[model samples]
Target: MKPGSLSHGSSTAWGKALRRPAALQPHLPHVRTPPTPRRAHCPPIRCGQVPKTPFEGFVARPPNSELHLGNAWSLAHACELSYLTQDEVRSIAEGRWGLKGLLCYGYGDNDGPDTQCFAAAGPDFIVVAFRGTTSITDWVRDLKVWKLPDGPLGCEAHAGFLEGVQGKWKGRSIIDSVLQGVRDLERQYGKEEGLAIYVTGHSLGGALATLAAAYMLEDPELRDKVAGHYTFGSPRVAGPRFKKRFEALAPAGRALAHRFQNREDVVSKVPAWWRAYDHVGRWWYLAGDDQVLMRNPDLWTRLRDIIDIDWDFQPDFVYDHQLRAEGTGGYIDGIEKNIVRSA
Candidate 1:
């Protein structure tokens, strides 16, 4: 089967399978159902590490002209590039991605690096990509589900994600460095030339990207410069308050932020609703069989989908979170396929 293809009748079967057992059926009013599953106890899954040469043997495809698919493919590649070493990233930025004046940050932090991001400029745009979980420390951070009450926009957010965005290196926070890079790019190319800013990442990096974009949007000078923020397999990073603030800050009629959730990508479901965490921005659900839902499915639909997941497949959670180049059931693969279909 293709990366995003589902077997026939799977959805209907899953929905039917979720019917309450006889013991817990409505007729048995005296019977109590089992407690809901606690996802907190589940061990953290490792985010995939792409091959050292991520772009090797792969040609950059012209993106479909549609806004979402075009930006999705480009931002997905930017996220893939985040995993490379600085030199390799720089070389590829200029050669493959056609980027100029690259600014790489968060490398060589032996003391303990909390985040990594890079800003690369093209003739008409700039992309800020955040690196996803790549170390034991990253996994540890991912497990830190605690919320900080005083996060960005004066709303609550995942403590670890907030730290990743606000943590300082050499007296400068990650967002600060990223903004400085953006400013430099605007000056070099002339903001009059309409240099749009795009922020993106996968998994843990996606959380940081969302937070970073939120911070940028709050800034008067940078707010209008932001074109869009895209994330893949990103877990919930903020609470309802933050979501409200983000929606207010986002431009009217323009979907400035989008979260792409691949089929059964467990990372996107984390810091569960029970923890008061909520996702920000429009959701794009990549249902198997080349179907993409622009909005989140209803609760019952989501529940049924969860019940239908193939848990028998070992490492299913991690497998769905991968960002492989293409044809490997990864985010990039899914987005590229969507791009082809849209074309």
Candidate 2:
């Protein structure tokens, strides 16, 4: 039987369900409105009963092991925080996550419209999260698919993603600011404390996270300190050379860095493979029915999965890409459930 063939029972039940006529619908263009500012005391959109403490089960030690589901859950929330105003983010960082400080940066002021991201530090970890696509300018950046020789080892990265990380904020590039933040944390806690740095984001932000992590890992001083990078629904950011160089620098031979693709998220598949772009690190496939596959499916299986999308009666690609708060069918929902099942 062919891999992922329905008759062989190799495909998931979720894949089978998608084949039903009712599941077919024309793809709609997604337009996201700006998120309204919320009171600092209220929790962000959640899946279930809210926790008293954020990232409650996160464990930063033993960095050599495979990516932990707890860490994925925590980092997903960190990406969610990037969407909020700086003051709200600071409140969550201090009140919920117990982070000592939050430094939010808005760059591109001198060059173009601003882009925003933040770095939050605590005793055990530092999280640098880039906000995902939420504006017309952000969409323009995402569509700029040209490649440039910007990554390590002569590797080329998506020109827009490279720009996103290299653009200056107060005369310092985003990459430099991230490094300086790590340095400050190291100075405060001392290297003996083993401050683990995690870079994360969603969609366009995810591409930036991968590039930023790659840039930081290239630095000999900060390489050992960076724990990993976690991205969600992120597009491919670089070519094969970048992937090769990144593996050399990553912990556990690329196991530490993971890209989570929930169901049939269309965003993760571009800038098309034919265009010489490829993903870095490991792939965590969040299957259609909430099961998390540690590694991506084989090529044949992946192709079958794509065919299951039914272009004529397409599922909402935009909906699948969302980092939803309600907890049904989003990245956070899938990872949160996986955490419980693993326990």
Candidate 3:
């Protein structure tokens, strides 16, 4: 399958599967039910990091309100956005899908630049999604969070992430692109009908999305228009100072800012608590029913369930990062089951 193809069993599959679920699965329920078992004759699943088979049943545990199904779908959408190419983005724009593509901006001018993201508008919401680092060099960028750049935004952020978000793409600032996407949506959809703006991504993309949402919230008008900021497998993006700033800017209920942590995902724990970096806003934990080993975590608690660094070095680290297979576990599986039932 190509970069943007809707290959079965990947994020793209979820994107196509969910395109019109509004018509089919009117409400993505948060119930638990077993998935269909695979036939004995089927080949042994090839994917080892995460289970390829969907989980038997799913029961969501949102820290605050009932699991926000809309937030779950947005996460799936944001994940899919990371897979799209410029051409495929155009195809989605011209198609009948509920999501209309707007921008696919990236400064791939050099070998490995830490700047790339996209934006889009639906009837009632606008989405700004950042693509996680795709190259080894980009991964190097992920590690360089040592210095705080001088700026009016005194709150210190993950140094690399701050630079990535502030960098220019195609002669225009990436932040400006996101803001412009929202403004264009407002022009087309009108800000009045309770239109929402969602900033989301997975992994590094999630970090950038968090930064974008924080900046948006600083503007009183934008804060009211935003419905939620959702991220999957996102790392710590700021220190306590910025955390306090984010809380004051958006608060918990003002606009939902949720970090969906997959069970044992080692990435979410990085820029570690020991390093004094803190996760902002609410944490909605997603793990298998059997893996319900963790209760809600406190600010200083090192994620109790994360695969420990001292443990055996292996693929389990990578497996924990995968979006739970269709029914295996995590937020997407719940939405997948609901879609199947609706169909």
Best by TM-score: 2
| Whole-model Cα lDDT of every candidate shown, in order | 0.66, 0.67, 0.56
What is the descending lDDT order?
Answer: 2, 1, 3
Off by over 4 Å in 2: 1-52, 107-113, 251-254, 299-314, 325-328
lDDT of 3 by residue, 1-343 (tens): 2342222333442244322211222232222222222221211112222222211111122333233544455456556545556566556543524556466667334322455677666666666777764544456668986757442146777778877777776666778767777777677766456556777777777888888888787666577676667787789887887777776765455536767675556778888887878987666554343332122544223243342342324333344454443223444653443343323
Cα-based TM-score, every candidate = 0.76, 0.78, 0.70
Pairs of colliding residues, candidate 1 = 4-288, 4-289, 5-289
Q: RMSD for each model, in Å, please? A: 13.0, 12.1, 11.0
Cα misplacement distance, residue 207 of candidate 3 (Å): 0.5
RMSD of 3: 11.0
lDDT value, candidate 2, whole model: 0.67
Q: After superposition, how far is residue 161 of candidate 3 from its true place, in Å?
A: 0.6
How accurate locally is residue 328 in candidate 3, as Cα lDDT from 0 to 100?
Answer: 31
Model 2 lDDT at residue 185: 70
In model 3, which range of ten residues has the least summed lDDT? Answer: 38-47
- Give per-residue lDDT, candidate 2, residue 163: 82
lDDT of 1 by residue, 270-343 (tens): 98998888988877765543333435655554454455434243333444566651222556766565555444
lDDT at 117, model 1: 81
